[model samples]
Target: MSKLGENLLKISVILMVLLSLFLSWKIWTKPANHQFQDRTDKVKAVIQKKEMTEVYMPTKLFYHHGSGDHFLYTNKESTMKSLHEKIVSLGFGSSKVLSTAEITNLTTKRDLFNLVYPSPIPISLFINMNNVSATLPHDSKNFLFNWLVMSLDDNKLYFVDYKNKTGIEFDIKGNIASIASILDAESNNYVTAILPTDELNYAGIYYLADSTKLKTYSYIIATQSFTTFSRGFFNQPNDLFSNEGENLSLSNSEGESLTIDSKTGEVNYFGKLKQDHSESINELYYETFQYVEDMGSSLGNLRYFSDTGNEVIYRNYVEGFPVFGDNMKGSMAATVQNKNVFIKANQDTLQIPLPSDDSVTLVPTQEVVDSLINKGVDMSKVSDIQIGYKWQQNKETQQAIDLVPSWYVNYDNMWMTQEKLESILVKGGHS
Candidate 1:
């Protein structure tokens, strides 16, 4: 070959080798967090487009941890109008049985849609008591109400028993907050103590009525603790995210005295309300999930856990699992006086991918019960047993958190964690 041709050939070979090395380096050194970039982008797109995330209401054999055995039944045409009709017909107090075919079709549609669509759909399942599945283990004697409302928002699935004639409601964060509207007039005025619960957290305010005494009650159930406030008063209309998306400001009618960090949605109001409580703690919990005004992020589901004196505590649930934080964290508390509702939430969300269901093996209910009984727990006294995820601080990486599967036993006044519940099964022992 000619010398000029040889030179060109050698240069081309060198360029190809350099390009290949660069590509390899880029692939090998890619950040671990960016692995799910495509999925994250799609989620962002869906949010920006305001796409109606399909909400599935199943009507068939359903088996999950939260709700025992319940299914939604409808004989009307398959349309959104029909769905609304079903909800309205069940208004106040109503009960009726549905046929097997209706349930089968509903169940089929749900399964088929989920299988075809990669994106997740928020689902709420309603189960009637009279027609619960025969194969499912049930405690009819232990039943608290006639209907069960099971809701799935993002990763968390919450189940609560509802009495006949009660309407269902979802908070701003897409959690079941139907019970929040119920007013315990006695507790609202004079509540000194509140125990923890497996449900979402809550908070509110009350007038002690000792020469116009006011108290702000806050509780964090995951850690089983409460925060209180003495007599103090702030001016009316302490607006927080009122005008579309505005940060909260506190003042005594002069000007802005204290401006809360809107991102965290923090508030320190221990005063009386100028207006009535338009929204309960449950409503505030839902609103926080949608927009935090100055806070540039949304939160996961915050389910109602418990309430004490005019206050309620709700916990954050991500990907259908409960998140655990220190006493100062883990849950959101609210204080309501007259109609003024003050919420204290310090939780935030990250757009990270959730661990696959296959990665976490759920502990069976029976096994959990057995473990509790072996641990000397009185089954009769045990209120609720739920399988959920708890966030544990990753000691190896500061500021990083790990979601660990946990068995939470709600007994007496607090939530008990039996980390060793899985160990018994691993050791091949079941009495």
Candidate 2:
């Protein structure tokens, strides 16, 4: 009986050990092929061929920041050689090896001729001659011309005539006669005429107008030409007097004074002045005219003049009416009079007294106090509720401040005003 039992037990133990080893192997060496496949599908769903095409692919443009003239062309060798030749022809020195990323950065800093992809030749050569002119030596005949026959974007082949201060724009549309008439009219006396050029697909001419026999500039931007007007006495005339204009009685630190006329845009100047002045001069401050303007259909022109030193006194006008009126329009009328301050509104008044600090204190209303008492709030334990009200409504310090019991040094010594305490208590429905 004992032998049979021992044999059975030994067989069972061996079988259990074999089963445990198999399970451990399966868990440790299992392939992660399903996990990899799940990740691949997720990436495929998010990345599409069309979306990838929108990304900016590397082009054949190269840049060389070294001392020598070098550039990188297309990704292809044949295309690179052709672009190299074109760059040399454009007076870009010589060509050398450069990286595409470097070329992109250079293009952002300075305009470069964009080349056609797959094609070795540069399709469009862009020259920012406006910025280039600053670096080049100034010459009367210095001009930039584009002989390239191709066109891309808004770029067009044209020649700039810096000698005559004229630009000939090509590929222009519309009737040239109407443009010529408008240019001639606004050409002022400085421009001679706007003639049409004989170039194909191009129209417009550059004419030099007389400006009192003095040479003046006529700026040409695209299809427009701006003729500068010469300075004349009538150009800036004096301003008219008006009410609603700022009272210029205040002393100005700036010496310049303004005179304006509302009937027309006329401005006059009284130059600069100094600061120190006696009572006699101070009395004349009201009579002193700082600035005038006629506020017609517009908000009116404002003139700033100096009464003393270099400080400017701003004066505004209301429909070209002077603020003084026949009489002093109550210029210095005292609207508010208090023990500590006198407030007045005047066109040319100065030196008014400011409100005193701590003039008003916020206190809880009597009603609130009564309610607190009814609520069993110990007056000895509760701090006095002070209500601070600004005597001057315009004062910025009149903001409400919360007065908790902890803010008071002695709860029993709460010294809130009767009026404020009553107001707070009544508003709280306690009184």
Candidate 3:
């Protein structure tokens, strides 16, 4: 009886050990196959989802550079190569300074361009109301030409075509026509031909219409009505007066004086000014924001662009997107010094309405980069690639401006739009 019992117990113990080993092996192998299948399914789903929702708005604003029209890059690599070649052709050999057309191209959306390159002002405004449309390097040989004329009687400005003798009146108020170079204040007659430089600052100039010779004069007047002074020298407003049609001079008995634009009201103060406080760059940035807030203007965030000895530049963001004006100098600007700060903010005048839906599905950043590379963007030459918003006017009106998502590539000392780059790449069969 003892031998039979021992044999049976030994067999049962062996059987139990074998069963446990089998179960362990099965558990490990089964889950491995299942996990692999699960990961593969996820990868496929992501690919399909991206394909389904890839369409985006192509509303980015495009501009022309010198010898180039308000052009879009139809071929990526060639277009970029073209711009790069133009820059290299200048023979500066790595000089960062661009041409007037190139700088105009870079600063066309100065508010956003400052994001790509850097500037001294902290915030820029999207100014479309004052912008006039004309081809770059205004060709004198063109049959049709444009000129700006001021009617003293109505205190109005107009864009006139000499060929057609037609003029579209401007809605500018105030008696500012005298600020132009060619104005007859008594007779209410002033007119000037548009120049390339005028396109930069949108300043006032006067031109006389003489068949034999075209005479021109320029004017800039900056004004200030101060409420706060860093120094305790309280002065009366009587100190300020128009020394000429284009100049408004403000002088204090202390020998300090300021000159301002009579028409645009732009002011530049010279001489010793007192300072109550000196702010760091970050502090100045916050101060600029507070200045905008105090004016009860629209809500927009500031992204620092650049700074110099006297001024700092920042780009304005609304709903977390950058606003683009005609050039990158920005629409909003401030002059902060040791003792006094002067801010000229244009947001109060812009009429940008948010999109019905603020959300957008952007193309993946990597894919965008790949597209750019294919279009001929030398990654080595690109200082940076950034995502921001560029504002575009509809029907040349600021009231119907659209803030669009955009990709900016800073290369060859210029800021170019992704739409221009993509078009070139896609046309090259890279899309």
Candidate 4:
């Protein structure tokens, strides 16, 4: 063959070979339906091996333990047990089982992931580790460990850093007022807390790589007024409690209080109080005027008998009682004396007198009257009155009455009823 013909023939053969190679590469790398199915199967195998019976396919796992109860995902007993084991394996120490309610009490939006174990201490200690999944500016290797030290009932989220021995609390915004290091991130210390800006009027969870530095995350829905009768605090946008009219309550380590709202679950008002006050204070204060529903029905005759019973029945109506503090047995009292309502705290017999036709006047000691005057409390304008006190222990029956005063005002004409009077008495001295 001629030289030119030979060269052309070689070039044609090489072109054909290149075309075949390109087609083969595309066929080999393309993903198929079967391949996708195989990947799903692998994931299922791992889940099965872990014995996770209640699997939320698309949901991220949430775990917590508190007040002798353990919770994971939802309030399922089986899932709680599995989570307990997983936490133990992850280096948690001896733990006592806690109820789902208790676990929820320990968690906040910033918590991301947590593992709490029941303890005798007034506050429960749990490993509050930053959830890499929930965090922004994501780093694959950075790990943060924080000790969430909080009272079983207090709304304060205290972040304790054992390594650095320093902490800050994020009140209400991220469960507590402080965020310390429970785990280290990037060999440097990281802290978490809630930061509130007056411009926003809402609090956001912040992560700090070091002192004086911060990275803010999503805004947290503070517990608003009128939604204080439920069992949980700080519901997420996606949480079931986020729905309107979800029974909710506000609480601190010291106590819990109830209120009702017909509006949405988002905390609308920042609460009419100072920033230093605990978040639960608003609920506790509001509860003083609120009546507990079905207390007599739920506890039957036992509701009015025991000291704890009375407190429990009236807790939703009192502001001073700790939501999660020691359950002290006591009696509450309220009365309208003269034009002013007088509330006194003592362990004594409680007697609430009926409304009288004659004008009643509360005669506080001159010292107390002076104090009220200093604080700008207008005694002359105060016509409606309430009183509450703790009953004293009696040696005869081995019983004592601890009275707590709570009262409220009637929306109509502002006629002071005994119920409102009692709540006011408690609210006056407690807040």
* lDDT at residue 176 of model 4 (Cα atoms): 24
| Clashing residue pair totals per candidate (backbone < 3 A) | 35, 53, 36, 70
TM-scores of all models?
A: 0.39, 0.15, 0.33, 0.15
lDDT of 4 by residue, 305-413 (tens): 1111112122211221111101222222122222121111111112221111222232222333344445544444432222222222222222112222222222222
User: Which tens-of-lDDT digit does each residue in 39-81 have in candidate 2?
Assistant: 3333334432321111111123232222332222222333333
Q: Higher-lDDT candidate among 2 and 3? A: 3
Candidate 1 worst ten-residue window by lDDT: 223-232
TM-score of 3: 0.33
Q: What are the lDDT figures for the candidates, one per model?
A: 0.33, 0.24, 0.34, 0.25
| Top candidate when judged by lDDT against the true structure | 3
State the lDDT of candidate 1 residue by residue for 362-395, as single tens digits.
4445555556666655554444555445655544
Instruction: List candidate 2 segments past 4 Å from native.
Output: 1-134, 137-253, 269-431
Q: Order the candidates by lDDT, highest first — what do you get?
A: 3, 1, 4, 2
Off by over 4 Å in 3: 1-310, 327-348, 351-361, 380-383, 396-398, 412-416, 419-431
Q: List model 3 lDDT by residue over 286-393, tens digit each.
A: 434333333222223344444445555455544333455443322445566655655443312232232233344455445555677667755555544545556554
TM-score of 1: 0.39
Candidate 3, residue 386: how far the Cα is off, in Å: 2.9
Model 4's TM-score against the true structure: 0.15
